[model samples]
Target: MPTREEVIEALEAARKKLLTEDAKKEFKGWNRTIQYYFTDSDEYWHFKVEDGIPGELINTEAEDAEIQFKMKEDTLIGLIDGSINGMRAFTMGKIKVKASLKDISKLQKLV
Candidate 1:
């Protein structure tokens, strides 16, 4: 298990990685606001993707978030680090996502 700071650092890293041009091109035209809540630490990270890439990352909740996800810190870290598959984790009940079908479908590739 990672400490809270370590998990946050990983998320920051992921946010940077997600903003790269190559990453953005992969999910072009999919714009959405996302909220991630780490259950273990009770921390929230809110961000948005516009025109297919990550926009800004902030340490507060977004009132208009189009998608919300919840999971353990370690699990989130694993997902970001590629140690855990998003689909597998979601199916296994390790993570929970709240969003409309369209948004969820588009977010699949982004994750």
Candidate 2:
């Protein structure tokens, strides 16, 4: 398992990647908040997107989160590093997402 800091770093990297592509328009244009909960770290990482732009990771409380994801640190790193596919992780029961199918698909495309 990675430390909490590693997880936060990975999430930050993902945010940068997401913001650079058309995927950002598709994913964050919804102007919603997404929260990631790591079971191993017992920490919540939040991304607040506004008009197709993603802001900094919110280490504090997530306000009005529209999507939530639960996973362990290893799986998150693998997914973020492109070593593991998000769909495969979900199907293999390594990751669990709580969100609408439309929103999930947008994020999956980004990853």
Candidate 3:
């Protein structure tokens, strides 16, 4: 169980990864509202990616998020920190995602 601060820190790292030059090219012209819902803490965090650049992490939900992730705090942190694999986690029932297959694949770019 990660604390809120830990989750935020992990998200900050993910945000930085999204801003890298390689990521920029890969995500070119992609824009979406991504939401994270931690089942353990009942906490929500979201961020908007515009033109491949991710903005600040907002500690609230996005009513119109294009992709939504639901998981435990540890799972969220693990995915962001590379300690856990997203696809494996999804297969193992550790994470739940609500998005189109395209968006789900795009998420592989972030986590």
The runs of at least 3 residues in candidate 2 whose Cα sits more than 4 Å from the true structure, single-residue gaps closed, are none
Q: Which candidate is the best by TM-score?
A: 3
- With a 3 Å backbone cut-off (N, CA, C), the pairs that clash in candidate 3 are none
The list of candidate 1 runs beyond 4 A from truth reads: none
lDDT by residue for model 3 (1-111), tens = 777789889878877888888899999899999898988888899999999999989998899999898999898788877799888999999999899999888767755
* Number of clashing residue pairs, candidate 3: 0
Candidate 3 regions off by >4 Å? none
lDDT of 3: 0.87
Q: Give the number of the best model, judged by lDDT.
A: 3
Q: Point out the higher-scoring one by TM-score: 1 or 3.
A: 3
On lDDT, who's better, 2 or 3? Answer: 3
For model 1, where is the 10-residue window of minimal lDDT? 102-111
lDDT, each prediction: 0.81, 0.80, 0.87
